[model samples]
Target: MDARRNDVNPQKYYVKKLCKIIYFMGLGDCWYERTEQSRMQKILYAIWATLINSFIILNTINELLAFLRTDLSVKEKNDSIQFRFAHPCLCGKYIFLVLQKHRIRALFERLLEASRSVYTVFEVEKRSVWQAKLCCLVLAASSYCTLLFTVVDAIVGYFTQGIKIRTEVVLYPTPAHSGLLINLLRLLIEVHWWCIVTNMILVDCLSSVAMVYVAHKLMIVKLYFQNLRQKVISNIGKKSDLEIQKEYEMDFITGVKLHKDALWCAKNIQYALGNVYSIQVFESITLLGMCMVKMAKIDINLTFILANGLYLVCVVIITGVYFSSAGNITYEAYEVHNAMFHSGWELAHLSPASRAVVLVAIQRSQVPVFLTAFGVVVLSHNNFISVVRASYSFFAVTY
Candidate 1:
């Protein structure tokens, strides 16, 4: 095992390390196994997840009922309405995260499988590796910064005001009167909040990383097609007619196989993400509008407003990145047609059989590959822009 570990590439090593961290946090398991022990572990994790999910749901309901029972003016009514809506949305987001555990595990497994399959084609290629590394770094930096800000903000608030501030999606109910047992309970609640927040951040960041990695795989496949075109052009006139024809046929077959594999990889990714993709889109738009409404309100605290603003920005940026990467995948898939078109097949003087193979390849290349969310929304830069526009419109109306 040590020897095998040492044989791994630096990029893969770092990526696996990050995935392990995510798995240990109960976000998902990258090394999913079907052993008895693995089953037992998963069962335990599921129980814990269900407990946390139930707690959040119950707390949200309690908060909602409490808000409904209170008397308020028009402004307070607006605030209450917003808060009520926001709590359920937040709970739904957490529930989405929890329910996606198995899907996340499947995604990571597919990612590893795809990477291994394509490694020989891209082992020496630095561009995709660098892009993936940059993505991982960005996710890591953002997660750390956000968590640090939450912790420091809470600590500073407590020291300055002698009151603990909650920094998680679900607010814990604490007694107003202070006592030793109450203080201990508050500390435990804070710990639980931190754990939940940390898990949420890790899951989100790792999911983004997985998407970026899949995009890199698509890029590698595209590069392979480009290289195949070069091979077709370079092999021209170098050998006898029969030999050239054979070589072209061989290359064509290889290209088809690689393209099919790439498509299969993409299909797996889409399948894994399909269930939650639309939910994520709706959540982002709704949360962005809610944050904007909170920021517009006159009586909200600056710090709270700033936090929501940061969250809104992060949601926008993350959504943009995800859709942009999906767009790149589509572009790469479509570029195959151009590569085949420019490969100088006409100049190769191929036999009828070889020409037939090239024709089939060209036909296959003409079909554009796309990743869709919930089998409805195609993930692309254009769609990303549309979502942002719609979100902004919603915010304007609400404001």
Candidate 2:
């Protein structure tokens, strides 16, 4: 009964912590915080709880295997949702070590390559245009095919499966299901669940891509600024106003370059926050829209409406919390702005020959942003298509 006793015991403490880890990793909430319990007892409790809950989840999924075979498993159907709920892939335990030894160097190598390719205009370069377009087209076609398949499958199921097609109506009935208003609310709630899950997944994926790409872009910009900073420092012996200003510009650029990686990391955080912002807005609209549709479809508030509403609220809150940590996107943009002006200033101060070189470097620096923006716009459009298809299933039920 003395849980505290177990706390002092390392083995017991380890087990308890392990259980909490398991629950936190997959399960939504950790209602079982062991403080008063003894170390040994807490450890045992955690191990037992984790095993039991995991078994329940596994068995439930297994029972639904047949249904999943014909329909989508919650995991498959809810890929985006599950993906969003999971921790970012960037936060690995060994990442810092990898970054220290390899990632940083690798990033620098990439920057070097980017720098070498600075001769071409970023947006209008003729060399890679067809290649980029081809890639984009291929990606778009694949995503479109997937979306079409999901749509056709859902439509076929809606017509063939009869009334039982509404998974919420059959499996999650409540006392109020007998009422028309309550059934409609239940339907709305189910729709909300699916939408939230899918949207979150999309946002997570987009965030990951944005973070990595932005980090690389920032790294290149940082290097360029660093070169300028060094140039100014080298010229410090010549103390004329132009030289001093050049030196000052160099120092400013150097600072920007030094903070480039940090700024890049910050941009990723901002992108993730932007994702949260957009997802929250979408979820809010979903709930409100679902409520109106509920009245039209079943004539009452579905019983699960409150539960789904609470879940949505929690998601919104948690995402908002993440967004809060990310701070402002504009801050990173401003830093980039400063870097640009300084680089341009350096070009102006340079001899005609050096000015040409600086101009090329500046042009090259803009390439990554242009390409990334274009990629995101295209990929996200595909994601939008998926979102539409996923929603059609729930709509079929109402029809």
Superposed Cα RMSD, model 2: 16.9
lDDT string for model 2 (1-399, tens) is: 001121122222332343344333332222223246578975776776566445433332332332323344342333322222221221221122122323332332332233233321232222123322333333334333433443444444457543222332112343224578766755554453343233233333223323333333443354455455555555556566466565554444444444444444443343323434344334433433343343344322333344334433343333332232222233333445456556445433555654554456455344323111212321232343443343344445543
Look at candidate 1 and give me any clashing residue pairs. Answer: none
Top candidate, metric lDDT: 1
Q: Which stretches of candidate 1 lie over 4 Å from their true place?
A: 1-15, 32-111, 114-119, 123-129, 140-164, 168-177, 300-302
| Clash totals, every prediction | 0, 19
**Cα-based TM-score, every candidate:** 0.77, 0.35
Q: How much lDDT does candidate 2 score?
A: 0.37
